[model samples]
Target: MPAARPPGGVTVRRLTARDARALTTLPPAMSWIHRTWGGPEALARSGCAWAAFQGDRIVAVACTYFLGTTYEDVACVTVPDPRLQYLALDCVDALCADMAARGHTPSWTCSTSNRPGRLLAWTAGFRPEREYAHYAVGAPAATGRAAAG
Candidate 1:
């Protein structure tokens, strides 16, 4: 990485198990990352995760496990607070760059209905690899407001 300073005195670092707690505070839906793979155990397994911290606080996070020139299973979640959006993008940039450096062409995916997800993926340089109709059953009724469960 370059010595150039990013805005808001933000800095990026590899996320460790230590970050799991703080990451879990981001919002319930956002907590899935920590719940699933943000802890030390997952990091000890097949993949790596990274975060952007503002001083001692985690502002953004990204994790990529599956690796391939064509696709990878990636999870990206940021603090829901809008003030943190820039930091999220910064973390994403670093993640993509690092993956490219490692000889893998990283790609991302989102459900066709996830508008913001699609927007974020496109802005981050991932193109549509494929799309398919998905079916769901026994799920709660969809609501524009996030589900509380």
Candidate 2:
């Protein structure tokens, strides 16, 4: 497949199992890619992960980290550097395109508190499919913060 070239000369490409080692260097904010996929190796094994590399550094990643029975989930991450603005977005768009070509209906999720994640998901064309709610079953009244906390 053709690699995606984002601004600033970053190369975005689909990852292979052999590329697992490169994922290990993802910044802490992007660690969920490893956690959700059961490690970098398993993520690569999914055959649906991609990364944006600035030279030898993996500055961003977008992957189908969770394959669900109903819908697929994509997780994205990038170095929080302004110079890399849109780098993560480009990686996700490329990965999502790959997912679409495979006939997968991919969805994006984020901790309610993650503003950047929400923005990226929206920027990638994902709208809220559902807003989840939890029940306390008549417990004490809650504070102003809901799931967003």
Candidate 3:
């Protein structure tokens, strides 16, 4: 299926090196564009990412953040603005469609508390497949596991 049409005044396209500046404006929580893809420079080079923009401002982005044996981990975020409704969905739909064309299954994950993300995934036909928890721990400590000989 063709991707849903983005909202008027919003345009979606493949992420490029020029977007590095706009990507920097995202807050830490939306830093997946950095942490997962090693910043906009890398993501642009990967050619597996897309962004929604209103002129020079990046309003949303969807990217394959991880690659498993048979699926691509999908991540997306939109600027926090109520007026930008449907913006993220449009961006995600376009990205998912492109991934499908490339034969990559998309795996989307988000904290259960993220209602907006969940809703967007749902709207994009993604259903829950598994549930897991992640923790932010301090510096790694070595466990006393003897090496197998």
lDDT of 2 by residue, 82-118 (tens): 7778877877888888777877888987777789899
Which regions of candidate 1 are displaced past 4 Å?
A: 1-5, 38-41, 44-47, 65-70, 139-149
Residue 89 lDDT in candidate 1: 60
Estimate the TM-score for candidate 3. 0.80
Two-way TM-score contest, 1 vs 3, winner? 3
Inter-residue clash pairs, candidate 3: none
**Judged by lDDT, which candidate is best?**
3
Q: Whole-model Cα lDDT per candidate?
A: 0.67, 0.79, 0.80
* Residue-level lDDT tens digits of model 3 in 1-149: 33457667888898878778878877767877657777767887677878888888888888887877678878888888876777777777778887888888987988988987898898889999888888888877655655332
Candidate 1: lDDT of 100? 72
Q: What is the lDDT of candidate 3?
A: 0.80
